[model samples]
Target chain A: MARVVVDVMLKPEILDPQGQAVQRALPRLGFEGVSDVRQGKRFELEVDGPVDDAALARIHELAESFLANTVIENFTVKVEEEKAEAGE
Target chain B: MARVVVDVMLKPEILDPQGQAVQRALPRLGFEGVSDVRQGKRFELEVDGPVDDAALARIHELAESFLANTVIENFTVKVEEEKAEAGE
Candidate 1:
C-alpha cells in the first residue's frame, strides 16, 4: 500500500473567516505570543496499490470537485511510499 | 517579509472525526473515486522581517500552546524564502 497527503488552503486573496476566528481566539486562549492563525485542511489516504501519477491526478480532480471549495480554497496533493515495519 | 507554513495532523492511529464527516459526504458530493478523507490544519504567516529558525521555534511553541491539540495532533513547520517581484 501507499500513502497520499492532500492539503487544502485558501487562495492568498481570499478571506478565511475560520482562520480569522482562530486568529482572534489565539490571544484569548492564553497564547499571547501568537499574532494570527489561518486554518486549512489536510487529508491522508492509504491506497490499496501503488501510488502513481495517475492516482495523484485522480486525487486532484476529486479534491477540486468535492473535497475543496474552489471559491476560496486551493489544493496540493502528494504521494509517498509507505514503509511497513516488521516484527509486531 | 517572509512566509512560514505550518501543518497539523492527527497521529497515524488517531481518529479524525472531521475527516470522517467529509469522507462520508464525498459520495453525496458527487465524487465517486474518493475512498476516505482525513482533515488537518495549514497555516501561512507573513513576518515583519527575515525568516529565521528562532522565529520558527516561537511559532512552534505558539502552535503547540494554542493552535493544535497535542493530545491527538502533531505539527510540522516549514520556512520558505519568499521572493519579491520588482517593477510592480
Candidate 2:
C-alpha cells in the first residue's frame, strides 16, 4: 500500500486561540525558550492499494468531505511515490 | 524572511494512544464518516531573516533541542525556496 500525508494548517490571517492557549500553558509546564507556538496538524494515511490518479483524487475527496474545513484552513497532500530508504 | 515547515510524526513502531483517544472522541463530537485519526504535528516557522545554510542549521537545532522528542518521533524539514504563487 502506498502512503499519503496530509497537513492541515490555519490560514495566517486567522487567529489560533488554541495554539495561543497551549503556548501559554507551556511556560508553566517548565518549557522555556519558546517565544510563540502555533499548533497545526498532520495525518499519515495508507491507501489500500497502488498510487494513481484515481487514488489521489479519492483521497482529496475524503480530505474535503471529512478530514478538514477548507474555509479556515489550508491543506496539502503528498503521496509516497517510491520505496522509503528507512525500510532498507 | 524565508519560511520553514516541520512535520513531527510518531514512529510507525510506536503505538499512538493519543491519536486513538482523539479518534474515539470525534464521533461523539459530531464528526461522522471518520474511521481513524492519528494526530501528528505541523510547524511553520518564519526565520527572523534570510534562508541560508546557517539559518537552516539553527532551525534544525531548535527542532532537536526544543521542539520535539527525537526518540519516539521523526521529522522532515522543507524550506520555502521559491516565492509562493498564492501570494500573487
Candidate 3:
C-alpha cells in the first residue's frame, strides 16, 4: 500500500489564533526565541495499491474538496513509497 | 529567520475519530479508492536567525513538552532550509 500525506495550512494572510496561543504559552513556559507560530492539519492516507498518477489526482481532488478549506487555507499532497509502519 | 515544522500524529494503537469521519465521508462524495485515513496536527514555527542544532534542540523540547501530548501522540520536527513563502 502507498501512503499519502496531505498537509492543510491556513493562508498566510489569515490569522491563526491557535498558533498565537501556542506562541504566547511558550514564553510563559520559559521557552523563548520563537518569532511566530502557525497551526495546521495533517492527514495520512493508506491506499490499497501502488500510487499512480491517477491515484494522486484523485487524492488531490479529495484534498481540495474534502480535506481542506480552500477559501482561507492551502494544502499539499505527497505520496510515500510504503505504508507508515504501526507504532512509528 | 528559519522555519521549523513539527508534525504531530496519533499513535497507531489509538483510534482516530476525525480520520474515520473523513473516510466515511469520502465515498459519499464519490471519491473512492482510499483504504484508511489518520488525522494529525502540524505546527509551523518561525524562529529568529539561523536554525542550528541548538535551535533544533529547543524546538524539540518545546514539541515534547507543549506541542504534542506524548501519551497518545507522536511528533517529528524538521528545519526547513528556507521560510515558506506567502500564498502558495
Which one is best on TM-score? 3
Docking class of 3: medium
Q: What would the TM-score be for candidate 1 when compared with the true structure? A: 0.74
DockQ of each candidate relative to the true complex: 0.29, 0.23, 0.58
Give lDDT per model, in order. Answer: 0.67, 0.65, 0.87
lDDT tens per residue, model 1, B31-81: 545566667777766555655677777777776776667887777776756
Segments of candidate 1 deviating more than 4 angstroms: A24-37, A82-88, B23-36, B82-88
Encode model 1's per-residue lDDT on A1-88: one tens digit a residue.
Answer: 6667777777768878887887677666654444545677778766556567776777777777766788777777777575332111
Residue pairs with backbone overlap in model 2: none
Checking candidate 3 for backbone clashes, the offending pairs are none
Pairs that clash in candidate 1: none
* Stretch of 10 with least lDDT, candidate 2 chain B: B79-88
lDDT (tens digit, per residue) of candidate 3 on A8-31: 999989999999999999999988
Clashes (backbone N, CA, C under 3 Å), per candidate, total 0, 0, 0
Q: State the lDDT of candidate 2 residue by residue for B1-88, as single tens digits.
A: 5667766777777788876775666556654444555668877665555767876766676666556678987777678656342200
Candidate 3 TM-score, true structure as reference:
0.92
